[model samples]
Target: MEVFIRHQDKNKRKEEAVNFFIEHKTNSYISHSEIMSGRAKSTTEWSENFADILSAELDEDDCNLITIEDIHNKIIGIAILRIYRKYLIIEDMIVDGSLRGMSLGKKLMDFIHNFAAEQKIKALFLESGINNDKAHSFFEKNGFEKVSVTYIKTLSE
Candidate 1:
């Protein structure tokens, strides 16, 4: 499979991107209560909520899209980025669950690094839950060091 990195129009690809993240959050969420308790919560972010946050913080020029398109023009993976306050953050990344172990994620990250380089970006940042070991490892292998930790405590049930 071949991955294509292009600037996807929000109006055109909103649903596809939404579905991808929603699936990621759902499929990869921490299932066991022992794990989801304490400081480790499931990485379950709804797509509509993400879309609202993105739309609020990012202008049209501040966002980008990367998709893995095969010969049939089907998207096997998707990655989103946001450039804000002189930092580039990988807002989300999700490959179709069935397409895992196929290196599509690598292709997507490569495209992201290349995009940053082209823009002469100095640094990049992303937030991944502890449950997402694969994603955290992927980012580390891609040269992202965890500079700080993001802490969250549930306030209500």
Candidate 2:
């Protein structure tokens, strides 16, 4: 399939990209706070909040919402990137669940790498959920290294 990668047009594509994120987030593990608050009980409940955060990020100067689309103009993959002076952080990346194992994810990563290089950025960074082995393997295959482990402790309410 012929696919094109480009920066998302916030006005035209924010909703579609947010919907894609909601659908594919099933692969992600719920956070401790979400579990404690019972917001993880249903995808429908927290999706609105998730949508709001994602939409706002798309409008930020440092955040770049990159999207990949098929020839038919359907969005197939997305990456939420935060660019810094010396490095770029990929906050989130998702490829259509139905299209897994198709290397679309690799295409998006390659695009990010090229963009970073053009800006003279020296490194790329991202964190994946500890339980998402599939994503860890994919990141390794794409040349990402495990630089550090993130530990979080939820404070009592």
Candidate 3:
């Protein structure tokens, strides 16, 4: 499969990415029980707000939105990076579960690294679900070391 990695900050693209993320959240990794468990925090509303904020931030040069399109020109993966005072964080990383293992994920990652080097970013940090072993393995295979364990507890549950 041929994939093209693109670095662009367009609203249409950002919305496409956000929609894809929310679509996955609704079905794949999250169950209804888990969704209800986080209702007190209004996780869904917060996520919607976040996507809006992120979409609005696309115009900033320090924020980036990246996507990978297959030969058909359909976006199969997307990632977003944000630069802060001390670190460059990959805030979003998703490859359509159907399209995993075709190296597109790694290609997008490489693009981020090259872009970061140009931006003179020194350190990088990323967060991923410890439940997603495939994602963890991919990051580990790409030279990301275990930084620290993150714990999450829900008060409403």
The numbered model that scores best in lDDT is 2
Question: How would you encode candidate 1's per-residue C-alpha lDDT over 1-157 as one tens digit per residue?
Answer: 6556566676676666655655555535333331333222344533334545444433456667767766776667777787776678886677877878888888888888888888878788887655778877878888889897655565676
lDDT of 1: 0.66
Q: After TM-score superposition, what is the CA distance of residue 153 in candidate 3 from its true location, in Å?
A: 3.6
List per-candidate RMSD values in Å.
5.4, 3.6, 4.9
Residues 1-157, candidate 2: write the lDDT tens digits: 6899998767788899988887778535443333434434332235446666667767777778899999999999999888777989887788998898888998999999999999889899887666778888999998888988755664666
Q: Which stretches of candidate 3 lie over 4 Å from their true place?
A: 26-62
Please give, for residues 1-157, the per-residue lDDT of candidate 3 as tens digits. Answer: 8788988656557677767765544222332232343411242333435455545556567777888888887778888788897678886678888777778888988998888898798877886644567777888898899888755565763
Clashing pairs in 1: none
TM-score of each: 0.74, 0.86, 0.75
Provide the clashing-pair count of each candidate structure: 0, 0, 0
lDDT on C-alpha atoms for all candidate structures:
0.66, 0.78, 0.69
